[model samples]
Target chain A: MILVMGPVDELVTAFFLKHLTDTKREYLFVDERHLGGDVRLELDLPQGPSGKGRLRGAVHFPTWRVGLEELTGIYSRLGTGNVEQRKTPEARAEQAHAAALLDLFPGPVANRATAMLSNGSKPCQYAAILAAGLRVPDTLVGGTWERWEPFARALDGDPVIKSVSDERSLVKQVSWEATRASARPGQALAPHQFQQRIHGTNIRAHVVGARHVLACRAETQALDYRHPDMTGHTVSLRATELPEPVAEACRRLSRALGVDLAGIDLIEPPGGSSRPEDWVCLEVNTCPGFMWFEQNAGLPIARVLADFLGTPLGS
Target chain B: MSNQSTDAGLISSQDLPKLAEAGHVAAPTVGNSAAELREAVQAALAEQWSLMGIIDTGKKASDLGKKAADALTDKGKEIEDKAIHREKDARDEAHRKMNDDKAKKHGREAGAHGATTNAFARALSELRG
Candidate 1:
């Protein structure tokens, strides 16, 4: 049996569940909203060798229960809803315990909780991206106007500003003068991500099971294709193929990050060759809402994701 | 040179209403002012378009709008319902015209989805931290 954890109504979770059901897979739906209420969890992991420990647990629903040992794999979207904002102590403990199980469960968790931590720090991911042989745009995490002046000067133009961490922010191109004019005297600006803006087509590659690579290109004049309205430009998405070397690099990056499934963003520079080094690595999303891609590009992301989750590790 | 490609639909600011029609994104309440309405629309757009990954593990669900699921705050929805009722009862011509203009500007019909709004995208952005 497979375990799907999240709000049943969330788009991505719902999409995955639909596919899993249509495929006739035996899976347990653990609704995060119902946790501590309609759903309960009991886990027992006695002390043992680091890798030899066995996680024994059972998830109890109103009318049924399933043992952790019976779970062949796990696909979790628990963070997709307000479950994390539990007010009651009981609710908090329940969520924490479930998260622990997701972290320690020795199976193909779409992404282990630990692997997902790489997304918390963009710079850290950049190091991994570079080591994976992908080009990382010049990025500055935090600095005052004086500190940033030289870095911005080295760029093609005013650098693009964005959120440093996983927090989502609009990617905006601002000139050095605009930044200095807005900065207060002698005070360090709040930590922000400023990176060299690469002129290219935006490509999102979904790497599944470190082998299946489905990619699409987003054609938009907007600095951030995600919010085309902000730039008054329409966005078109179409399925595309990644160059073999770049596709292989994405696979390596996913394996290195320990994310069984990853949404890897890249920028293919204008007039660039098919070489892996020509594509600029942006960031990897552990829990990608691939429904949008599937709907627009007609990529079989959901079906592939479902297939990946159904197969037990080392099968 | 075009890489291997397939036909995928387009998404843009103009496509906001289409998303509502397709039942993908929730239409927000028509705000009191044009600026507020635009904010609501952009927020809605951001809610639907921005590709945010898993929110912080322990943060509150204050940003549920990002997932584009659930109803807007109950209080806000109630207020929206009351405003619509008042407009209908009073037969306020100017109020109605203003709403129509706002709707046209945003490419969304005013009160399109009744009183309930989708999760507020601004709230979702704030909680993403």
Candidate 2:
């Protein structure tokens, strides 16, 4: 049985459920909106010899009680909105317990909690990307004016300033003039990430497991193409192909990041050359939203996910 | 496990162990109470959440540090402006002092020349006498 965890109202979740229904797969969904009412977890862990212990539990939903051992795979997009804001001790404890159980789930989880840690820090993600033999833009993190001034002066064009962490901060281009204007006579006070901006089309490659890759090309001039275009409409997405080496690099990046499923962002330089070396690795997104890719690329992402979970399409 | 059906879609209690026997499901290891299990899970989650919190706190601290640095930069700019003004005032004062000294020096030279002329005229008169 496959276990899906997330907000039921989420479009992604709905899509997955619809695909699962089409495949007639036995599955359970743990909705965040209903903790005690719609779902409750009763887990028991017994003391046993080392390496011999097994976790036993059942997640009771209003309609089903799913045995822990029956779970073949888990697709978790659990957000912290419902649990993170609770101040009560009971709620906190329940959430923590749920998280622990999730961590302990022994199945083909799309991503284990430990593997997801890299996304918390872009630097960590970049290191993984670099380890995968992908090129990352030159980056400077948290330096004083003394350091930034020379770096700014050396850059051929404006550098992109962004948050070092994963918080959604605007990718603002730092013109040489802006940097000079903002310069003060001391070390840089707060943490900022500056990268040599690469001019190219934004390519997002969704790597599913090791075998499946869906590449999408987006045309936009924004520093971050994830945001809407100037007309308040989303940037157009179309199915595209990557150079063989670049595709292999993306696969390697996915494995290095310990994610079976990931959205790997790359920049294809303006030149006609499709060489792997010409592309720059931006970052790996752990929980990528596939709504746009599904809508625009016409790729059956949900069906693919079902297949990854051991349920073939039209099973 | 009881054989009673608590919910419709759930597997009957009797069928659970049978499924386990069939190797469709593994037998559950039993010991801790549900509450204890919840507590354990919560403890584990707490650790994970704390780690996440640490990262978040670090980000916040970084942002605050940036804000403070920006404030310091603003203050520095203010001081820089004041210093520029002070430098300009000092330069103007020096220029005024130099100009005043030059004017005084010219005046002294003129006075000395006038005295010399007067003395010469007086000597001429005496000679004529």
Q: What does candidate 2's lDDT look like per residue over B21-127, in tens digits?
A: 11111112111343332333233333333333444455456547655665788875566556546644654454444335434423343333332233543432232
Model 1 agreement with the true structure over B1-129: per-residue lDDT tens digits: 001111122322332222212123343333443234334434433443332211221112422432333265676666655644653344334334433433342223112322211243222222221
| Candidate 1 lDDT tens digits, A2-41 | 7877655455665566566456677777656657775679
Write model 2 residue lDDT over A1-315, tens digit each, in one string: 777765443335544654565466666666554454445777776655323126678887544466876677778765521122234555455555566565555445676554555665687687778877777998888887777778877887888998775444547787867776666665353688888988888898988875578888887656666544322345667888888878888888886665767888888888635566678888888777665566566666777777787643123
The parts of candidate 1 lying over 4 Å away from their true place are A49-53, A82-84, B1-129
Worst 10 residues of 2 chain A by lDDT: A79-88
- Candidate 2's displacement at residue A41, Å, is 2.7
TM-score of each: 0.71, 0.64
- DockQ score for candidate 1: 0.03
Tell me the TM-score of model 1: 0.71
The regions of model 2 sitting more than 4 angstroms off are A36-38, A44-53, A62-64, A80-84, A180-187, A231-234, A272-275, A311-315, B1-129
Ten residues in sequence with the least summed lDDT for candidate 1 chain B? B1-10
